[model samples]
Target chain A: MNIHEYQAKELFEKYGVATPKGVAVKASAEYSTALGQINTANGIMVKSQIHAGGRGKGTFTNGFKGGVKFSPNKEKAIENATAMLGNTLVTAQTGPEGRKVQTIYFTEAANLGKRPDGRDDEYYLAILLDRATSRPVIVASTEGGVEIEQVAHSTPEKIFKVQVDPAVGLQPFQARQIAFALGLSGDLFKQCVTLVTRLYQLYWDKDCAMVEVNPLLVTKEGQLLALDAKVSFDDNALFRHPDIVALRDLNEEDAKEIEASKYGLSYIALDGNIACLVNGAGLAMSTMDIIQHFGGSPANFLDVGGGATKDQVSAAFKIILGDKNVKGILVNIFGGIMDCNVIATGIVEAVKETGLKLPLVVRLEGNNVQAGKATLAASGLTIVSGDTMADAAQKIVKLVNQK
Target chain B: MSILVKENTRVLVQGITGDFGARHARLSIEYGSQIVAGVTPGKGGQVFEHNGVKVPIFNTVAEAAKQTGATVSAIFVPPPFAADAILECVDADLDLAIAITEGIPVRDMVRAKRAMQGRRTRLIGPNCPGIVTPGRGEKSHGGCRIGIAPGYIHKRGKVGVVSRSGTLTYEAVWQLTCKGHGQSTCVGIGGDPVNGTSHLDVIKLFNEDPETEAIIMIGEIGGNAEVEAARWIKEHCKKPVAGFIAGATAPAGRRMGHAGAVIGGAEDTAAAKIKIFKECGISVAATPSDMADALLRIWKG
Candidate 1:
């Protein structure tokens, strides 16, 4: 659902919001060409295009200093791009394993306007759903180019929020309030109003979950430009927008997670030993918790949904086993609408199909639970049967630790 | 008496002709719910026959409510039109509208929720198991089963249950049933962020209900609805309350199956919510299996 900075800028331009022109390249050969396409007169910013924040402070696995580099010329730009592309970037957001930087973005570095006190005047603007109000809210602040959470915690007064009515949408007076709150006036104030209006329009029209422009810059030419763009679309509304769907980068996603989605399974990869397969999101999450509570860590969170057929179960097993960190597997089902017997038969067939070598624990409850448990018992497999969630978690932890 | 629904509450089915709607409608009727009318645009004057009971169908919710005197509606329309279906319920002025449809766009819900301001209808969920008030019968057959929850797991008693997830609600209900504890009513408020009801909303209803002696509130990581509910329970709720928050190990910024289960701010984590529950004097369940036991730890009945 998240798109890179370049793609977001493209959207900003489409919506008539000004941004520093940028080009994204996948190879070092295209790095110079990409830089040529942008206004690199002042300077070129080589940014690693991965789906995570804190790129400026990130380090490449190849001992490179920074994921995002400011190069004064084309030679240093290519050097920075070479160190980033095809290298893994470790940021505060991307876990210790890091995300592979597959694309490099080159953009023109804007000349930052200075305030009366000789400080760079940067501002922050973001549009997202305010859950408390159940409406779209525009968060604006005078402090920008830094973590907004930090600003919120340190100086709560500096932050200003304008909640828009979903029915009426962003009003002109509301846009003016944001501009005035950021201390804008004259032409710069007019530019801020236009930018805010266009961004809000893009957010609503594109069905974006969030649209954030950190360090919303004021250039020396009296223009407002979005320095950094981070946009994420609402996943449920993606069905209406095929153009947005094409922006999804499979390389940035976990392979097992992408594979699990194909089977209608919700899978999130984690770093642990025991793999958990459960019905329902909350149960799956608690399954992981109970595993850790019993002195074991879960390798992944996989929910086979309310109704899982035989092929989906088999596919889930294949996806779980795909993770090398998995030392054991736990199957927990609290069938309500779904029959436990069908789930049990699928588990039995999945175990036989994968020829699972790791220890397996199964817990079935709800409709036709006895027949489901009986199916698992008659499968002639070494599947540990658990009477409850607590018991199954303890069993799996003990089995994995014994190994 | 139940808080929202009972044995005598007449119900209508929206999108009754669809596969998911028809299936749960049949199940609700089989569980002895008084399903009086069906609403399918252009399918009016038709009768849906199932298990010796024939229910009349109508073209709109207004017609369905007027013709059948149905006060409650169970919506199973698809994602695209689910919002309009909710609006129809509001326009028809139904007493309660339970949206069983999943994958409704949040924007639609926001608009629908805004339009519903000052309205008379109380909406339950867009992606939920619906409400169930167990009746005094074999497998609770005479109970008002509004949504897709299995009726047999419930038992008519003094305990009230509220949760965000469907199967987890069933898990807690079954746990209580096995331990010889029955429930007055169980409500799933759904897992979406912009749902009609909140944990606090249901908790207040349960606290006010005289038949509800104890409460079990289940929540997950995401919004601050659970924390808000817990804070209210500390100052206002008189009954014993037990709480369990899922997604303790869920990574940040990942949607854990449910769209609303993602950890957003510093205050919405499972650990934070659990700590708040403890501070608010609500017994926290260590695991999902311990929901009933947690309540029993604080309350004898």
Candidate 2:
């Protein structure tokens, strides 16, 4: 689940990560009060708290590129923040959403000095799975921040990796190795170690898929701090961690996805008219490809998953039919552990309940195929049956086009 | 003559007290699997009859394995406790462990894999339809029971089949049966990326089987295992092999199918794997119906 920048920072603070002291103001009046809360005003950065990235560029309508005009006069800061807050900010990273800021973070901004060598130190730290080793690996780079994928791909050697054993967790010595490798010493080095250790704990404790601290900056005073943070939790592990689930901001998620989650079905909305519901993930993807291959677009990719009961199938069907864009429905089941007849019965029941009028095409195999088809046939629903996947694709494509 | 299991192999059922587990356990025993024992933590000391065979229930896999000398284990534990069950079976040094439990965390499987790295124990799946030794014996942990493949399919001569999909494995076996070619062993390695075993792992066993003359591999998208297997087959496999990858036309991106079956980034795709297998001199079946035809051609040649 994706959270807004302010929410992520809030979580970081809760987890004992040092973040810039700030106040989140929802409205223009709140912004006036926010300025008074800033204890020191060397230079305060008013960041639009949107879900998307790249908020720095073209986010503000009036193009306050250098910085928002902040004065002891709280009225000016409020005027500037209100204009940027509600208006959509189109950043390269924000994509098409161009996040509409609900709240803005008015916080103390940091000023940096040159490195020990009179050069800027560039480095970021991230902990992610090392696919090759099948272990959690810590990634540290001299080119801190920006897109780490690009750095890993273009110059992999520059990214220092240390694999952590799950039993021992992330050892301090290993964290220190990364710190020293990144050219840190003294108090700053200790701070870096502490932050890295904390990040690893967050990754394990929260069952996070990734914990990234971008721009792990070494200030002019040689103080190490995580300037930005991003944390992603494993959706499968959400059952074990209720606290992380509470962090989910439903407003930030796609409406269809949120609805699909309620049914315990994995649904990803796509721009297509034919809703494809298949039993297995591999088969579901293949069905989507087949739909596209036949000149039909798949509206959603829905997998009922293995061991799905009749109710779950019905729930999945309802979710698919809920989409107004879906002109046709394709039910593909290669019943492994599941009974095809049970699935067929569920489909018919779901369609009856929803009063589905869309063209339905089904291709079922394995256990109870005959019984499943018989049940569907007996249902008297206007359903089409295909002997094979190719036939199913053709029928669905033809039906969708007819619609 | 069959692969991992046969009529004589002693089988232990884990999670036998559960609804689906009990049902399949009864079916497998009725179908001719040698039901030796059952395991369910608190349900130990109870007796479950499988086709008139009174099997003693044990508290753990270790006890069941020790008492019954069960070489093969059919695990039906739920997702949460599946990893521990598998580890227990591995600890007992079972010859083969079939994890019928679905939805096991990939991280858990990763740890299990690490633990079983050098062990002789072979794992079929954390989520898969359990293997069958044709008409002689079957160990089905999956809920569905369509009956075992007919005895006629086992000419006991050659042909080793490996598949990622359980349903497709049945199809492949059915196709082989129609061609009057019986399988030496049919292995469902499972579709999950971090599953118990890979196609390459099974192929090595098949390659070493003197009775196995040819190999038919059924693979799906989402992992590089198929590609790696193709490379291995090209370099090391002495037996003639036929291959077919399911989901050749699968869309690019994450789609709900199997937890491990998403096509993200660059990896072994159906088409790419097919191309590789073809380059490796293995005949590729274009469709499920054509799989048997492809294998027949290789057998005749």
Candidate 3:
């Protein structure tokens, strides 16, 4: 549900929020044409478009200096774009493996306003659901252009939050309160109020999970602008927003995760040897934890949901085996609404279909579980049957470690 | 002396005509719950006949409640209309509305929950397994089964179980049943971030209930509901409590199947919550498989 900075800016613009004019290009051939579309007079900021944050401090695999760069001229902008596109970027957010840069964004750089003490006039602002209150909250801070968590941990007093009543939406007074809290006044203060109002509207109208604008900059010319945008939409609400769903980038997602979705399975890839396929979300998570607790790492977290057919279970097995690191598999089913026999039959069929070589340990409980265990037992397969979740995890960890 | 629904608590089904709703409805009826009526918007005056029992159908929850004296409703309406279904229960002034449907938009729940403020109805879940008060019959049959949980796994006893995950709750219940321990009531508060109820809310009810002598609380990585409940238990709860938190190995920011299962802040991790449980004098289960035993270690029978 996470979108790139360029897409977030486009969304911000659609809702009347002010942001620097920017152009995004996927190919090098479009770089000059894209640059021609934006205001690059003072300087053009070349930003690598990836889902994760810390792009400004990120380094490319090809030894490129920065994922985001400021070039004074058009030629320098093109050169920086050339070095960025198609290169993998490694940041604090992206793991050591990093993500490949598929798109480059060029935006007009702003003249940062300086305070009386010569500090940058920037602030952090984000709109998200405050789980504590079950309502939308606007988080504003004077400190910006850095991790908000660090600011929160270090100086919690600097953070300000305003909870909006869902029935009434965001109020004008609430917006003004944020603007004043950030020490804005006069025309800049008016601009901040307008921007906060528009951002809240966009957040509510678009069903966004979070809309964060780090470094809400005050230009020297007295304009408030969102310098960096990070927006994520709620997955549950995606059904109502087709336009937002189109913004999803499959390239940024793992292949197994995307494939698992097709079968109504929730799959998250991890780095380990034993893959777990469980019935429920909490059980699946605990299945992974128990695996690690038993001295074996889990390769993935896969939940087949409360009800699964033979085909879905087979698809789940296929997806688990897709990960090369998987040396063993654990199937833990606490069938409440789901029948264990169906899952067991699917496992037998999937093992035969994929010619599975890795060891699989299954612990089926509740709702015709005896039939399920019998089905697995009669399949003439080498599936290890555990008495409980802990037993299954230990068996798989032992089996995978034996290799 | 169950917390929410007992054996005779009259219940109704909101999407009784749909496949998922009808299936669980049949299961609930087979388990001997007093399923009095069905709500299908336009399928009024029809009878949902299953296993010799006939449930009268109504066009709205108000009419259903009025016709059958049903105080509780298990909502199986789809995500798009689930919020409306919850509001209908609130408007009808039902005692409890358990939304068994999953994947409801958080925006919808936020608005629904706000509208439900000071209302008569108590909401259980938008994506939950529902509540169960085990009957004294064979395999816990004749019990009041509200949502999609297997009734047979439960046994009417002095223990109370509360969890955020459906099957994980079942795991603990089964473990307790296997250990010859029975439960007074088991409640799944749902795994959504903005659910109708919280761990603290249910724990308070269990603490006051005379039948529930011990409690097992299962939570995962997400909101501070578990922590809040644990803190409250430390001060107010008068029973031996066992707790277990899942997602110890889960990565940050990843929605682990449940929409609310994502790790958000420092205090929302499993390790952090487990530490709080230990400090709060609750028995902490090292793994999911040990939930029942963890309680047995502290409270005997």
Candidate 4:
């Protein structure tokens, strides 16, 4: 449900929050036209657009000097954009594998020279739901250049928080309070107040799960600009916002995860060999737990849902076997209203169609247990049957390790 | 006596004409739940037959409550309007309303929760499986079932089970039933991020109920509800409490298919809770079968 920074800034602009002038360029061919859009006095900042944070400090695996580089002219801007476009970016958050940088944003760099207070021109601001209070909280700090997580972990006292009552939305007084907490005055302070207020308005109106403005800049002229932005929307609330849903980038997500969501299935890819297909969320977790306990790693976390049909079950199984790393498959069903016979038939059909070549173990319990077990047994596949959860987990782990 | 509903407890169905509502409504009546009325907006004045037992349908929960005098209401409304349906039951001043719908937006539930502050009505499961208290006598609605749980699996006994999952609660109950220990009641508080009830809420109810001797808490790697309950159990709970937590080996940050199943930044993982439960004198079960053995030892102690 997370949107890219450029998309977030576009949405922010609609809510009257001023974002730095930038044009998202997907290719070096369009770099000249995009650079022409942002008319800056000293050129622009070329930022590689990826989903993960720490992109500013990220490096391109293609031997590019930096994912983000300041270009003094149009020539250097295209050089930086060419280095980033279609290159993989490796940051602390992107893991060792890194994310592919599909677009580079050519943005107007702000003049955040030295302030009179001798401090750098960076501040941290974010709005997120505080689970402890079950309310939206605005977190602000003066130190923003470093990773906010490190600041949050070490010098938490430096971080200030104010919870917003949804009934009142984001009041002007609360925004001013945050503005004052960050130590601002005169025209600069008033600008901060206006910027904070508009940001809160966008967060509230857009139904955003999180709105983070790390290194919210305080320019030499006292004007504020969001140097970096990240926004994630509530997935359940996406039904109300179709325009926002269209901003979802499928290329940024795992293909299996996107495919699973299409079928109303929940799948999380893991680095294990045993694929787990269970009924409920808790059951799936427990199935994974016991597998690890018995010395087996889970290939993926797949839930076919409580009321899944034969086709959905077959779909779930095929998705699991699609992982070539799946040395074994465990079909765990605790059928209550979920007919056990239907699950058995689905497993049988999926195996028949996919042609199972690995170890398969199944444990079925609950309503129509007799018929469901009968169906699986009659499938005539060389599938191991387990009477209990522990027994089933042990069987799969053992059978897989034997190879 | 059970915690919430009993045989004589009159049940009202909200979103009665909907697929889940109509189906569970019939199933509830067959299980001996005294389903007095049904509520579906604009579907009033209709007679719904459940196992040949006729029930009246009302347009609103207010009218249904007024006419049927139903003490409890269970909702199967869709996610978008599920909170409002719950609010209707709350406004009608029902003792409890169980929302069986899943995928309700957290913001809507948070507002619903705030409006429920100091209200007479109690809520359970926006995405949860309903509450079940096994019928004890002839007058009992076969043991009152306010959810989709089948009645055949339950046995009228003392062990109380509270869980954060749907079918996993069924798994725990089956394990208990197989171990010759029938449950007094089982509550699935749903797996949503923000829910009305918690493991501690039902644990408190079970602690007070004389019928519930020992308790089984089914928690996963999520919010610190399990750890909080473990802390409370160490100080106040008089009866033995056994717990089974899922997601022992789950990776951090993944949602694990349940909204409330993510491991928090703090010490809220299953392994962390197991360590806490061990320190609190609560038997922690690794597998569901291990829970059956642990519960047997706990009640016996």
Candidate 5:
């Protein structure tokens, strides 16, 4: 559901919010044309569009190297872009594998003056789900272009929060209040308020999990602009908003996660050896915890969800077995609405179809549990059945160690 | 008398014509829930057979409630339509409504909660296994069967069982039954946020019930509802209570179980809740079997 910075900026721009004029280039030809389009003598900022933060560190582009430098020549921005395309860019923000460079955005760099009060003129504003309040809260701080979590921890008082009512939506007055709290006034402040309001509308309308505009910059000329933007939509709400779903860039995501989503299975790949397939979310986590507790690491956290049918379980099995790192499989179900026997049959069938060699441990409880165990027992695959969670974890750990 | 539902309670089914609705409707009737009427948006004036009872179907909850004098409503509407279904039952002045649908949007739940504010109607879950009372009757409005919990385990005893987990609740009930203990009432409050009731809310009712002796609480990771209830149990509630929280060492920031059953932050965890519950002098069960043993010890002592 997370979108790159350029995509978020495009959404902001569409809603009449002022953002730095930027061109997203994927090819050398497009990059050369972008250089002509910007025409700013002050030089342009070539930002590597990655989902992670802290792009300024040596992890990406050798720390930007003061202005922008091309490999062949500065004028051949297209050649430099071509060289950068499809390359993995490391950053303090990205993981060990490094985020792949999919699109490079060329934007006119901003030169904003310090505030009249001798502080940074910009501020960070993010709308995230506030579980405590059970609402989407707007988090704003005078500190711009930094992790909001750090600001929340270090200077909690400086962070201004407003819980938005989903029914009434974010009011213009609430946006104005936030703008004023960030020390804005007059037409520029009003413009900032208007932009924030629009962003809130976009957040709700698009069913976004988060809409963050870090460093809402106030230029030396007193113009307000969103210097950086990031938006993440709720994947569950994607069904209602097909347009946003279309904007998804699958190449930028974890391949395993993408594949799991295709099967309607929620899978988050982890660094472990045992691949877990559980019925409920709670049971899935419990299985993972018990696995870890028993000196075994879970390769992935996969929940087929509560109403999972045979095909979904079969597809989930394929996704789990597909991972080469998975040495063992643990299938746990506390079937309520879903039948355990159906899941057992699906797992057995999926193992046969996939020619799975991993050790399998299953504990099916609740509806049709006996039938489920009977089905697994009949399968030629070496399936281990445990009565309790502790027993299941113990058996799985033993099986994994035996391997 | 049982806590929320009994044999005399008239039941109205929302989304009754749907596949799940029809399936559970038949099972509930066989299990002894009063087969009053069913509500499906255009399926009024129709009757479905359950045992020997012929239950009439209506298009709306209001009309069904009026005709059958139904006191409890069991909703089987899809997730998107679940909130409205609960609201309709609330509007009809039904005493209790149990929603079986899962995956309702949190925003929709917020609205539903606001609508239910100041109303007498008690909502159970938009994503829960419905409540059950053993032989003297049961309400399985959700797609679950009440008969799954053996009638022998429930001896009309003073023990009250409340759980956020549906399947696990039945496991605990079955365990208690094996130990010659029957429940006064077993309520599955559900794990979803914006559910009909909380552990604290149900515990308060159980505390007031004369037939209820001890209580068994089953909670999961995600919300602070357990912490809130534990705080309440520490100060109020004179009876002994045993607690079990699922998912002790779930990874932080990863949602494991129910969409609402996620550990929202590091603190709102099963382990953290267990520690707090222990501090509150509540018997903590590490496993389902252990939960039953803890309850028995409390009851004996």
Candidate 6:
């Protein structure tokens, strides 16, 4: 899961990596604390806290200049924050609709540019999986603040890689090697070594899938700092790190998605009108595919897993209908380990409670399929049952188009 | 002989006391798999009896393999300890180990894969349906079910199937079986980004097997396995191959993801992979029934 910049910086401090002094403004009311407290002789960076990248290049839909703005005074900082709070920030990554900025990070902007020892030269640093090696790798570049993908694509030689052994871990010697590679000297080299080691430790200890420090900087004082922080933890490992999970912001997530997760259902809202409910992740995608192939667009991707209960199935229906864009529903279940009858009961339960308005097409296969079909049929509901996946997709498309 | 498993493949179960472990163990044995022993730490000397058949439980895979001389192990350990479970089987020196558990951390899988490199054991999945050889279910029966695949949907024949999905594999096999194109063996390589076996691994085994006439390869989005297999088939596969890719309609990127989900590699989307397969002289199936059609068109006049 992705955490905000403030949380990532907090982790950086906890792990011995230097970061610009920053405070998270929980709401527009708390702008005073964020603006007044941070010591920014260089300037204050009014950074809009969203989950996407390209924030510096992105503009707010509310006619703000940038998601991040460097201002000289507290008044300007609060003004930027006021413009950013609750406004939509559209980045290349955030798509056209954009993400609603719920919080803002007020950070001390640094004195950027070349120092006497070439220490102010910013460099890109990130630790992520090099899938080919099946190991964690550090990608470092002399060019910083630019997209690392662009750098890797343009000048391949400038990008340096250090593969950290999963079993042996990131060795101190390796960290030193990276420090030397970045062309650091003396105390700066040792400080970089410490920062690199600390970054590795945070990544390994936190079960983070990736830890990126864009524009990992060196101050005029020969100090190493992470100018930007983006770390995402593996969701599977989240159970072990409740402290990290607690950093999750509900405002940053889609309400429908959060509700679906509570019911143990995997659901992603889309721009279509036909809602898809299936058993496995693969099957769910295929169901969506056939729906599109049949000239219908899927409103969402919903997978209830192998052993979902009747209540979970009911919850899935409620969540699917929660979207006003949904014109029809398609339930395609191939119950191998899952029972079809249980799914059918859930469908029946959901319809009885919510009183279905939109047309729902049902296709049940595999174990206890007859019982499942019987349950739907006997419920006195207008659920359309198809013989095959293709038949069901076509039926849903026809039904939705008619509406 | 069929690839990977047959009637003589003695099996050992890891994490045998759990619901999935116990249920699948009973199903595998009943479907004629020679399940000799089970392992659940601290539950040693216990017996899980199903339908008049008792499976002896051991504390360690080492003990299970040693006492039973089991060459194959099926894993049902929970996600947290699953990699260690796989490591246990790998260290025990089993011929083939299939991990039936899902939700294992990718890092653990990477470490497990690293450890298994150049090892004697061949691992199948950490979240797969496992392998099944048709016509070896029992001493006299016609199937040897290793995973949770529905036994009713298979029949012994000349086609070898390898897939990354569970029930979708069943879907394809059912379509083939209904059309008189019985399978030799079907293996689910699991759907995770990092898994034990690849499509090429199973293809290599199927290519060498004389009993297999045609191969059916099932793949989905999110990985390079299917594309790699297409390359391998173009270069070395001796038999005709039929291909099907799930998730033709999978969203290109993650749902509000930050990183790690945005993969630049493997443009192995359904259309892309199908284009690759078609370019590599492999038949592509758009749907489950299309799989049967492809196999029949390749094998028959």
| Predicted structure with the largest TM-score when compared to the true one | 3
- lDDT for residue A296 in candidate 1, whole number 0-100: 96
The full ranking of all candidates by lDDT, starting with the best, is 3, 1, 4, 6, 5, 2
State candidate 6's TM-score: 0.93
lDDT of every model, 2 decimals? 0.93, 0.73, 0.93, 0.85, 0.76, 0.83
The per-prediction tally of clashing pairs is 0, 8, 0, 4, 8, 5
- Residue B85 displacement (Å), model 5: 2.0
- Model 4 C-alpha lDDT per residue in residues A356-376, reported as the tens digit of each score: 889999999987889988988
Q: Tell me the lDDT of candidate 5.
A: 0.76
Query: Which of the predicted structures, 3 or 5, would earn the higher lDDT when compared with the native?
Result: 3
- Which stretches of model 2 miss by more than 4 angstroms? A1-4, A14-16, A23-29, A33-42, A46-106, A113-120, A336-338, B136-184, B190-193, B211-223, B240-257, B262-264, B268-301
i-RMS of candidate 2: 4.1
- The TM-score of chain B in candidate 1 is 0.99
> Candidate 1 lDDT, tens digit per residue, A291-398?
998899999999998777888889999999999989999999998878999999999999999999999999999999999999999999999999999999999999
lDDT of 6 by residue, B1-301 (tens): 7899986788989978998888888877677778889999999999978868788899999999998899899999999999999999889999988998877887888789989988999899868889988773322254677878777678888889998777678778877876777788999888766777888889999999999989999877765778888999999999999888776666666621111223354474678888899999898876654777887777771
Off by over 4 Å in 4: A113-119, B137-141
Candidate 3 per-residue C-alpha lDDT over B1-301 given as tens digits, one digit per residue, 9 for 90 to 100: 9899989999999999999999999999999999999999889989899999998899999999988899999999999999999999999999999999999999999999999999999999979999999999999999999999999899889999999999999999999999999999999999998999999999999999999999999999998999999999999999999999999999998999999999999999999999999999999999899999999999999
Model 4 RMSD in Å is: 2.1
Question: Which model scores highest in DockQ?
Answer: 3
Full-model lDDT, candidate 2: 0.73
- Model 6 spans > 4 angstroms off: A115-120, A180-189, B136-142, B255-268
lDDT of 3 by residue, A64-127 (tens): 8789999999999999999999999999888888999999999999999998999998899999
Higher-lDDT candidate of 2 and 6: 6
The worst-scoring run of ten residues by lDDT in candidate 3 chain A lies at A335-344
lDDT of 2 by residue, A1-403 (tens): 4565566667777777776677878788676677778854466667776666566655454555422334344555565676776776777655554556667777766555466676566577888655445568898988775777678789888889899876567888999999888877788788888878887887777766677777777666666656666777655567777777887776566677777677767788776899988765545666776777678888887877656778888888877877888899998887745678989898889889988888999988767789999999999999999877768988999988976
Cα-based lDDT at residue A290, candidate 5? 76
TM-score of chain B only, all predictions? 0.99, 0.91, 0.99, 0.96, 0.93, 0.93
- Regions of candidate 5 where Cα sits further than 4 Å from its true position: A54-84, A90-94, A116-118, A336-340, B136-161, B178-180, B191-196, B247-249, B261-264, B269-271, B287-290, B293-301
